[model samples]
Target: MTVKEGMGEEPERYRVEFASGTAASVAKRRSFRDLERNDIERDLPGWPAQPPFKVRGFFGKLGVHVLSATTGLLMLPLYILAEALGSPASPEKRGELEERENEIDDFPVMWAGEGETARTLPWQLDPSRRSWRTVTEIELAEQDGLVRIWSYEDTGRGSRHLSWGGGEKVPGSEAVLWSMPRSEITSAEIKRFSMAESDFTVSFRDGSWARLTSSPHGARRIVALLGQGVPEGCHPA
Candidate 1:
Protein backbone atom coordinates (compact mmCIF):
# COMPACT_ATOMS: atom_id res chain seq x y z
CA MET A 1 0.00 0.00 0.00
CA THR A 2 1.11 3.53 -0.81
CA VAL A 3 1.68 5.97 2.07
CA LYS A 4 0.09 9.40 1.53
CA GLU A 5 -0.22 12.44 3.78
CA GLY A 6 -3.35 13.38 5.76
CA MET A 7 -5.03 10.17 4.75
CA GLY A 8 -6.27 8.78 8.02
CA GLU A 9 -7.18 5.28 6.93
CA GLU A 10 -8.72 4.09 10.18
CA PRO A 11 -7.95 3.45 13.83
CA GLU A 12 -5.97 0.25 13.11
CA ARG A 13 -4.65 1.64 9.84
CA TYR A 14 -1.08 0.99 10.89
CA ARG A 15 -0.52 -2.64 10.06
CA VAL A 16 1.05 -5.10 12.46
CA GLU A 17 2.63 -7.76 10.34
CA PHE A 18 3.50 -9.70 13.48
CA ALA A 19 1.94 -10.00 16.88
CA SER A 20 3.40 -8.50 20.04
CA GLY A 21 5.13 -11.71 21.17
CA THR A 22 6.88 -11.95 17.81
CA ALA A 23 9.88 -9.84 18.73
CA ALA A 24 13.24 -9.78 16.96
CA SER A 25 15.29 -9.96 20.15
CA VAL A 26 14.90 -11.77 23.46
CA ALA A 27 15.66 -8.64 25.46
CA LYS A 28 12.95 -6.87 23.50
CA ARG A 29 10.42 -9.44 24.56
CA ARG A 30 11.40 -9.21 28.20
CA SER A 31 11.56 -5.44 28.13
CA PHE A 32 8.17 -5.12 26.47
CA ARG A 33 6.70 -7.58 28.93
CA ASP A 34 7.82 -5.40 31.77
CA LEU A 35 6.40 -2.42 29.91
CA GLU A 36 3.04 -4.12 29.62
CA ARG A 37 3.17 -4.93 33.30
CA ASN A 38 3.08 -1.17 34.04
CA ASP A 39 6.61 -0.99 35.48
CA ILE A 40 8.23 0.63 32.47
CA GLU A 41 5.08 2.37 31.28
CA ARG A 42 4.94 4.87 34.11
CA ASP A 43 8.43 6.11 33.32
CA LEU A 44 7.44 7.05 29.79
CA PRO A 45 4.70 9.69 29.74
CA GLY A 46 4.09 10.39 26.07
CA TRP A 47 3.68 6.80 24.96
CA PRO A 48 0.94 4.77 23.40
CA ALA A 49 -1.51 2.90 25.63
CA GLN A 50 0.08 -0.24 24.18
CA PRO A 51 3.85 -0.55 24.03
CA PRO A 52 5.84 -0.94 20.82
CA PHE A 53 8.87 -3.10 20.05
CA LYS A 54 10.47 -5.60 22.40
CA VAL A 55 13.85 -4.14 23.42
CA ARG A 56 16.75 -5.47 25.47
CA GLY A 57 16.82 -4.93 29.18
CA PHE A 58 19.43 -5.40 31.96
CA PHE A 59 21.45 -8.17 30.37
CA GLY A 60 21.16 -6.65 26.94
CA LYS A 61 22.42 -3.26 28.07
CA LEU A 62 25.29 -4.93 29.91
CA GLY A 63 26.33 -6.82 26.81
CA VAL A 64 26.48 -3.64 24.76
CA HIS A 65 28.67 -1.96 27.35
CA VAL A 66 31.02 -4.92 27.51
CA LEU A 67 31.40 -5.00 23.74
CA SER A 68 31.57 -1.23 23.36
CA ALA A 69 34.48 -1.24 25.78
CA THR A 70 36.37 -3.35 23.30
CA THR A 71 35.14 -2.78 19.73
CA GLY A 72 33.30 0.53 20.25
CA LEU A 73 36.93 1.52 21.30
CA LEU A 74 38.39 4.94 20.49
CA MET A 75 34.79 5.93 19.89
CA LEU A 76 34.39 5.26 23.63
CA PRO A 77 34.01 8.96 24.33
CA LEU A 78 30.92 8.89 22.15
CA TYR A 79 29.16 6.95 24.88
CA ILE A 80 30.14 9.42 27.57
CA LEU A 81 28.79 12.97 27.85
CA ALA A 82 27.00 12.36 24.57
CA GLU A 83 23.64 12.96 26.19
CA ALA A 84 23.80 16.57 27.37
CA LEU A 85 22.93 17.64 30.85
CA GLY A 86 19.26 18.52 31.35
CA SER A 87 18.37 16.61 28.21
CA PRO A 88 15.09 14.96 29.19
CA ALA A 89 11.77 16.40 28.04
CA SER A 90 10.06 18.81 30.36
CA PRO A 91 6.62 18.12 31.83
CA GLU A 92 4.94 20.18 29.16
CA LYS A 93 7.09 18.54 26.51
CA ARG A 94 6.26 15.11 27.84
CA GLY A 95 2.58 15.99 27.61
CA GLU A 96 3.18 17.19 24.07
CA LEU A 97 4.90 13.91 23.28
CA GLU A 98 1.93 11.98 24.57
CA GLU A 99 -0.67 14.04 22.72
CA ARG A 100 -0.29 12.08 19.52
CA GLU A 101 0.45 8.83 21.28
CA ASN A 102 -2.95 8.94 22.92
CA GLU A 103 -4.53 8.94 19.48
CA ILE A 104 -3.03 5.62 18.47
CA ASP A 105 -3.48 2.10 19.82
CA ASP A 106 -0.44 0.29 18.44
CA PHE A 107 3.01 1.35 17.22
CA PRO A 108 5.24 0.01 14.51
CA VAL A 109 7.57 -2.73 15.69
CA MET A 110 11.30 -2.31 16.47
CA TRP A 111 12.51 -3.54 13.07
CA ALA A 112 9.64 -2.75 10.77
CA GLY A 113 10.13 -0.83 7.54
CA GLU A 114 10.84 2.89 8.04
CA GLY A 115 10.53 2.40 11.77
CA GLU A 116 13.66 4.44 12.30
CA THR A 117 12.40 5.79 15.59
CA ALA A 118 12.70 2.31 17.08
CA ARG A 119 16.40 3.08 17.61
CA THR A 120 18.01 5.94 19.47
CA LEU A 121 21.27 7.69 18.65
CA PRO A 122 24.43 6.39 20.25
CA TRP A 123 25.74 8.70 22.97
CA GLN A 124 28.66 9.65 20.71
CA LEU A 125 26.41 10.45 17.76
CA ASP A 126 23.81 12.39 19.76
CA PRO A 127 22.45 15.54 18.15
CA SER A 128 22.63 18.95 19.81
CA ARG A 129 18.87 18.94 20.25
CA ARG A 130 17.88 18.34 23.87
CA SER A 131 14.63 16.66 22.88
CA TRP A 132 16.49 14.00 20.94
CA ARG A 133 19.30 13.51 23.41
CA THR A 134 17.13 12.60 26.38
CA VAL A 135 15.44 9.89 24.39
CA THR A 136 17.96 7.08 24.48
CA GLU A 137 15.62 4.55 22.86
CA ILE A 138 12.65 5.10 20.55
CA GLU A 139 10.29 3.60 17.93
CA LEU A 140 8.02 4.85 15.14
CA ALA A 141 4.37 4.26 14.19
CA GLU A 142 2.84 5.69 11.03
CA GLN A 143 -0.82 6.27 10.46
CA ASP A 144 -3.26 8.82 9.03
CA GLY A 145 -0.43 10.29 7.00
CA LEU A 146 1.61 11.07 10.10
CA VAL A 147 4.45 9.22 11.79
CA ARG A 148 4.95 9.09 15.56
CA ILE A 149 8.32 8.58 17.24
CA TRP A 150 8.24 7.03 20.70
CA SER A 151 11.09 7.49 23.19
CA TYR A 152 12.38 5.18 25.91
CA GLU A 153 15.10 5.48 28.51
CA ASP A 154 16.39 2.84 30.85
CA THR A 155 14.97 4.26 34.03
CA GLY A 156 16.87 1.33 35.42
CA ARG A 157 20.02 3.10 34.28
CA GLY A 158 18.99 6.22 36.16
CA SER A 159 18.90 9.75 34.70
CA ARG A 160 19.90 10.56 31.15
CA HIS A 161 23.03 12.24 32.51
CA LEU A 162 24.04 9.31 34.70
CA SER A 163 24.22 5.84 33.25
CA TRP A 164 24.69 4.08 36.55
CA GLY A 165 21.61 3.95 38.76
CA GLY A 166 18.94 6.34 39.89
CA GLY A 167 15.65 4.62 39.28
CA GLU A 168 14.49 1.36 40.76
CA LYS A 169 12.52 0.55 37.66
CA VAL A 170 13.74 -2.69 36.17
CA PRO A 171 13.37 -1.98 32.42
CA GLY A 172 12.61 1.07 30.25
CA SER A 173 10.89 4.42 29.61
CA GLU A 174 7.89 5.01 27.39
CA ALA A 175 6.70 8.10 25.49
CA VAL A 176 6.01 9.22 21.96
CA LEU A 177 8.68 11.91 22.50
CA TRP A 178 6.99 13.62 19.52
CA SER A 179 5.83 13.08 15.99
CA MET A 180 5.30 14.86 12.66
CA PRO A 181 3.27 14.60 9.52
CA ARG A 182 5.06 12.73 6.76
CA SER A 183 5.39 15.87 4.68
CA GLU A 184 7.37 17.48 7.46
CA ILE A 185 10.16 14.90 7.15
CA THR A 186 12.58 16.09 4.47
CA SER A 187 14.66 12.92 4.18
CA ALA A 188 16.15 9.91 6.01
CA GLU A 189 19.51 8.15 5.63
CA ILE A 190 22.07 5.98 7.40
CA LYS A 191 25.68 7.06 8.00
CA ARG A 192 28.36 4.44 8.43
CA PHE A 193 31.54 4.98 10.43
CA SER A 194 32.71 1.37 10.57
CA MET A 195 31.42 -2.20 10.41
CA ALA A 196 30.15 -1.83 13.96
CA GLU A 197 29.08 1.82 13.86
CA SER A 198 26.22 3.43 11.94
CA ASP A 199 23.67 6.20 12.51
CA PHE A 200 20.28 7.27 11.19
CA THR A 201 19.75 10.92 10.27
CA VAL A 202 16.24 12.28 9.76
CA SER A 203 15.51 15.88 8.80
CA PHE A 204 12.30 17.69 9.66
CA ARG A 205 10.65 20.65 7.96
CA ASP A 206 11.55 23.05 10.77
CA GLY A 207 15.22 22.86 9.77
CA SER A 208 15.85 20.61 12.75
CA TRP A 209 17.13 17.05 12.53
CA ALA A 210 17.26 13.91 14.71
CA ARG A 211 20.14 11.44 14.70
CA LEU A 212 19.43 7.87 15.80
CA THR A 213 21.23 4.48 16.06
CA SER A 214 20.61 0.87 17.08
CA SER A 215 22.32 -2.54 17.04
CA PRO A 216 24.32 -3.38 13.93
CA HIS A 217 21.39 -5.38 12.54
CA GLY A 218 18.83 -2.69 13.25
CA ALA A 219 21.05 0.03 11.77
CA ARG A 220 21.24 -1.77 8.47
CA ARG A 221 17.46 -2.06 8.36
CA ILE A 222 17.15 1.65 9.15
CA VAL A 223 19.36 2.49 6.22
CA ALA A 224 17.39 0.16 3.98
CA LEU A 225 14.07 1.71 4.98
CA LEU A 226 15.11 5.37 5.01
CA GLY A 227 17.44 5.29 1.99
CA GLN A 228 20.65 7.03 0.95
CA GLY A 229 20.55 10.77 1.48
CA VAL A 230 23.21 13.44 2.00
CA PRO A 231 25.52 12.71 4.92
CA GLU A 232 28.02 15.60 4.62
CA GLY A 233 26.31 17.84 7.20
CA CYS A 234 25.41 14.89 9.44
CA HIS A 235 26.58 14.45 13.02
CA PRO A 236 30.14 13.15 13.45
CA ALA A 237 30.06 9.49 14.47
Candidate 2:
Protein backbone atom coordinates (compact mmCIF):
# COMPACT_ATOMS: atom_id res chain seq x y z
CA MET A 1 0.00 0.00 0.00
CA THR A 2 1.17 3.51 -0.78
CA VAL A 3 -0.20 6.81 0.53
CA LYS A 4 0.76 10.20 -0.83
CA GLU A 5 -0.51 13.60 0.37
CA GLY A 6 -1.08 16.44 -2.07
CA MET A 7 -0.65 20.15 -1.72
CA GLY A 8 -1.43 23.39 -3.60
CA GLU A 9 -5.02 24.68 -3.69
CA GLU A 10 -6.21 21.52 -1.93
CA PRO A 11 -3.98 20.37 0.87
CA GLU A 12 -6.10 17.55 2.22
CA ARG A 13 -6.27 15.45 -0.91
CA TYR A 14 -4.57 12.04 -0.71
CA ARG A 15 -4.11 9.09 -3.01
CA VAL A 16 -3.86 5.61 -1.59
CA GLU A 17 -3.27 2.52 -3.69
CA PHE A 18 -2.98 -1.11 -2.77
CA ALA A 19 -1.14 -3.98 -4.46
CA SER A 20 -4.45 -5.40 -5.66
CA GLY A 21 -4.78 -2.83 -8.48
CA THR A 22 -7.25 -0.83 -6.37
CA ALA A 23 -6.74 2.91 -5.97
CA ALA A 24 -8.59 5.68 -4.12
CA SER A 25 -8.42 9.42 -3.73
CA VAL A 26 -9.13 10.38 -0.17
CA ALA A 27 -9.39 13.73 1.58
CA LYS A 28 -8.14 13.75 5.13
CA ARG A 29 -10.40 15.23 7.78
CA ARG A 30 -9.92 16.57 11.25
CA SER A 31 -9.03 14.20 14.02
CA PHE A 32 -11.93 12.74 16.01
CA ARG A 33 -10.30 14.15 19.13
CA ASP A 34 -10.38 17.71 17.79
CA LEU A 35 -13.94 17.26 16.66
CA GLU A 36 -14.95 16.06 20.11
CA ARG A 37 -13.23 18.96 21.80
CA ASN A 38 -14.83 21.46 19.46
CA ASP A 39 -18.20 19.86 20.05
CA ILE A 40 -17.87 20.18 23.83
CA GLU A 41 -16.68 23.78 23.63
CA ARG A 42 -19.52 24.67 21.28
CA ASP A 43 -22.05 23.55 23.86
CA LEU A 44 -20.75 25.61 26.78
CA PRO A 45 -20.85 28.84 24.74
CA GLY A 46 -18.24 31.23 26.14
CA TRP A 47 -17.27 28.93 28.94
CA PRO A 48 -14.97 26.07 28.00
CA ALA A 49 -15.42 22.79 29.77
CA GLN A 50 -12.52 21.90 32.04
CA PRO A 51 -11.64 19.05 34.30
CA PRO A 52 -13.17 19.34 37.74
CA PHE A 53 -10.86 20.81 40.35
CA LYS A 54 -9.51 18.45 42.97
CA VAL A 55 -11.44 18.31 46.22
CA ARG A 56 -10.44 20.88 48.76
CA GLY A 57 -8.67 20.10 52.07
CA PHE A 58 -5.73 17.75 52.58
CA PHE A 59 -7.75 14.66 53.59
CA GLY A 60 -10.08 14.95 50.62
CA LYS A 61 -7.19 15.27 48.20
CA LEU A 62 -5.35 12.45 49.93
CA GLY A 63 -8.41 10.22 49.68
CA VAL A 64 -8.74 10.91 45.94
CA HIS A 65 -5.05 10.14 45.39
CA VAL A 66 -5.29 6.93 47.40
CA LEU A 67 -8.29 5.72 45.44
CA SER A 68 -6.54 6.40 42.13
CA ALA A 69 -3.44 4.55 43.30
CA THR A 70 -5.48 1.61 44.52
CA THR A 71 -7.28 1.34 41.18
CA GLY A 72 -3.98 1.45 39.27
CA LEU A 73 -2.49 -1.25 41.52
CA LEU A 74 -5.53 -3.45 41.08
CA MET A 75 -5.17 -3.29 37.31
CA LEU A 76 -1.42 -3.98 37.31
CA PRO A 77 -1.88 -7.73 37.04
CA LEU A 78 -4.14 -7.42 34.02
CA TYR A 79 -1.69 -5.04 32.36
CA ILE A 80 1.16 -7.45 32.91
CA LEU A 81 -0.86 -10.32 31.54
CA ALA A 82 -1.72 -8.32 28.41
CA GLU A 83 1.95 -7.41 27.92
CA ALA A 84 2.98 -11.04 28.27
CA LEU A 85 0.39 -12.09 25.72
CA GLY A 86 1.61 -9.39 23.32
CA SER A 87 -0.32 -6.52 21.82
CA PRO A 88 -3.52 -7.10 19.90
CA ALA A 89 -3.32 -7.73 16.16
CA SER A 90 -3.58 -4.95 13.60
CA PRO A 91 -7.00 -3.63 12.60
CA GLU A 92 -6.96 -5.61 9.36
CA LYS A 93 -6.17 -8.82 11.27
CA ARG A 94 -8.84 -8.04 13.82
CA GLY A 95 -11.26 -7.46 10.99
CA GLU A 96 -10.44 -10.84 9.57
CA LEU A 97 -11.00 -12.39 12.98
CA GLU A 98 -14.36 -10.66 13.29
CA GLU A 99 -15.36 -11.88 9.84
CA ARG A 100 -14.40 -15.45 10.69
CA GLU A 101 -16.19 -15.24 14.03
CA ASN A 102 -19.36 -13.97 12.40
CA GLU A 103 -19.00 -16.21 9.33
CA ILE A 104 -19.37 -13.18 7.10
CA ASP A 105 -17.35 -12.23 4.02
CA ASP A 106 -19.38 -9.59 2.15
CA PHE A 107 -18.53 -6.68 4.37
CA PRO A 108 -17.34 -3.50 2.65
CA VAL A 109 -13.71 -2.56 3.20
CA MET A 110 -12.87 1.14 2.85
CA TRP A 111 -10.37 2.25 0.17
CA ALA A 112 -10.67 -1.13 -1.48
CA GLY A 113 -12.57 -1.79 -4.72
CA GLU A 114 -14.84 -4.25 -2.93
CA GLY A 115 -18.12 -2.63 -3.98
CA GLU A 116 -19.03 0.83 -5.21
CA THR A 117 -16.48 2.22 -2.77
CA ALA A 118 -15.48 5.85 -3.03
CA ARG A 119 -14.37 8.30 -0.42
CA THR A 120 -15.72 7.93 3.09
CA LEU A 121 -15.82 11.09 5.16
CA PRO A 122 -16.95 12.01 8.66
CA TRP A 123 -19.08 15.02 9.56
CA GLN A 124 -20.81 16.29 12.66
CA LEU A 125 -24.45 17.17 12.21
CA ASP A 126 -24.98 19.49 15.17
CA PRO A 127 -21.64 20.28 16.70
CA SER A 128 -23.00 22.79 19.17
CA ARG A 129 -24.68 20.47 21.62
CA ARG A 130 -23.84 17.24 19.85
CA SER A 131 -20.14 17.03 20.62
CA TRP A 132 -18.99 13.54 19.68
CA ARG A 133 -22.26 12.07 20.85
CA THR A 134 -23.14 11.18 17.25
CA VAL A 135 -21.31 10.73 13.97
CA THR A 136 -22.47 10.88 10.37
CA GLU A 137 -20.21 8.73 8.21
CA ILE A 138 -20.94 9.53 4.57
CA GLU A 139 -19.74 7.65 1.53
CA LEU A 140 -19.87 9.10 -1.97
CA ALA A 141 -20.23 6.41 -4.59
CA GLU A 142 -21.29 6.34 -8.21
CA GLN A 143 -23.82 3.80 -9.38
CA ASP A 144 -25.58 3.91 -12.76
CA GLY A 145 -25.77 7.57 -13.79
CA LEU A 146 -26.31 8.83 -10.27
CA VAL A 147 -24.19 9.51 -7.20
CA ARG A 148 -25.46 7.98 -3.99
CA ILE A 149 -24.78 9.62 -0.66
CA TRP A 150 -24.79 6.76 1.84
CA SER A 151 -25.05 8.10 5.38
CA TYR A 152 -24.52 5.88 8.38
CA GLU A 153 -25.51 7.24 11.75
CA ASP A 154 -23.56 6.02 14.75
CA THR A 155 -25.42 7.05 17.86
CA GLY A 156 -26.29 5.54 21.23
CA ARG A 157 -24.25 2.35 21.63
CA GLY A 158 -22.70 2.80 18.21
CA SER A 159 -20.95 5.98 19.30
CA ARG A 160 -17.20 5.78 19.95
CA HIS A 161 -16.23 4.37 23.30
CA LEU A 162 -13.89 6.49 25.39
CA SER A 163 -11.95 5.84 28.53
CA TRP A 164 -13.79 8.71 30.21
CA GLY A 165 -17.11 6.83 29.96
CA GLY A 166 -18.67 9.35 27.60
CA GLY A 167 -20.34 7.76 24.62
CA GLU A 168 -23.77 7.27 23.11
CA LYS A 169 -25.36 3.95 22.18
CA VAL A 170 -26.46 2.78 18.76
CA PRO A 171 -29.64 4.67 18.01
CA GLY A 172 -31.40 2.29 15.65
CA SER A 173 -30.29 1.71 12.05
CA GLU A 174 -28.50 3.40 9.18
CA ALA A 175 -30.24 5.01 6.23
CA VAL A 176 -29.51 6.77 2.96
CA LEU A 177 -29.03 10.49 3.33
CA TRP A 178 -29.73 11.39 -0.30
CA SER A 179 -29.11 10.45 -3.91
CA MET A 180 -28.90 12.47 -7.11
CA PRO A 181 -27.85 11.91 -10.67
CA ARG A 182 -24.53 13.25 -11.84
CA SER A 183 -26.20 15.84 -14.05
CA GLU A 184 -28.53 16.84 -11.22
CA ILE A 185 -25.69 18.28 -9.23
CA THR A 186 -26.16 21.85 -10.44
CA SER A 187 -23.24 23.28 -8.50
CA ALA A 188 -20.55 22.35 -6.00
CA GLU A 189 -18.08 24.36 -3.97
CA ILE A 190 -15.57 24.04 -1.16
CA LYS A 191 -15.74 26.63 1.59
CA ARG A 192 -12.39 26.80 3.30
CA PHE A 193 -11.82 27.96 6.85
CA SER A 194 -9.01 28.45 9.32
CA MET A 195 -7.34 25.58 11.17
CA ALA A 196 -7.54 23.26 8.12
CA GLU A 197 -11.34 23.06 8.29
CA SER A 198 -13.53 23.21 5.23
CA ASP A 199 -17.13 22.73 4.12
CA PHE A 200 -18.55 21.14 1.00
CA THR A 201 -21.85 22.05 -0.57
CA VAL A 202 -23.71 20.44 -3.45
CA SER A 203 -26.83 21.89 -4.99
CA PHE A 204 -29.43 19.69 -6.58
CA ARG A 205 -31.69 20.53 -9.49
CA ASP A 206 -34.67 20.64 -7.16
CA GLY A 207 -33.29 23.72 -5.38
CA SER A 208 -32.32 21.69 -2.31
CA TRP A 209 -28.75 21.47 -1.06
CA ALA A 210 -26.56 19.41 1.26
CA ARG A 211 -23.62 20.85 3.13
CA LEU A 212 -20.89 18.99 4.96
CA THR A 213 -18.28 20.63 7.16
CA SER A 214 -15.48 18.17 6.63
CA SER A 215 -11.74 18.17 6.13
CA PRO A 216 -10.22 19.50 2.94
CA HIS A 217 -9.55 15.95 1.84
CA GLY A 218 -13.24 15.10 2.11
CA ALA A 219 -14.28 18.13 0.10
CA ARG A 220 -11.84 17.17 -2.62
CA ARG A 221 -13.22 13.64 -2.75
CA ILE A 222 -16.70 15.00 -3.44
CA VAL A 223 -15.27 17.15 -6.16
CA ALA A 224 -13.45 14.18 -7.65
CA LEU A 225 -16.54 12.00 -7.52
CA LEU A 226 -18.56 14.64 -9.32
CA GLY A 227 -15.89 14.88 -11.97
CA GLN A 228 -16.05 11.20 -12.81
CA GLY A 229 -17.93 10.79 -16.09
CA VAL A 230 -18.48 7.05 -16.11
CA PRO A 231 -21.01 5.40 -13.83
CA GLU A 232 -19.83 2.18 -12.18
CA GLY A 233 -23.06 0.16 -12.44
CA CYS A 234 -26.31 0.43 -14.32
CA HIS A 235 -29.34 1.33 -12.17
CA PRO A 236 -32.10 3.87 -12.16
CA ALA A 237 -32.16 6.94 -9.92
Candidate with maximal TM-score:
1
Error of 2 at 8 (Å): 34
Span of ten consecutive residues with least summed lDDT in model 1: 15-24
- For candidate 1, lDDT tens digit of each residue in 1-237? 123334664222121111111111231121211212223332333433444334456776577557645755665455454545543322111111221221122222222112233222122122222332244333333444555544444345544444564533225445544455666666765433222434345654443344344554555554454455743432211
Model 2 global lDDT (CA atoms, 0 to 1): 0.34
67-137: candidate 2 lDDT, tens digit per residue: 65696788778777777889532211111122221112111111212112122222223232234444444
Candidate 1 residue runs with Cα over 4 Å from true position: 1-135, 153-173, 205-208, 231-237
Q: lDDT of each model, Cα atoms only?
A: 0.37, 0.34
Segments in model 2 whose C-alpha atoms lie over 4 Å from true places: 1-124, 127-132, 153-172, 206-210, 227-237
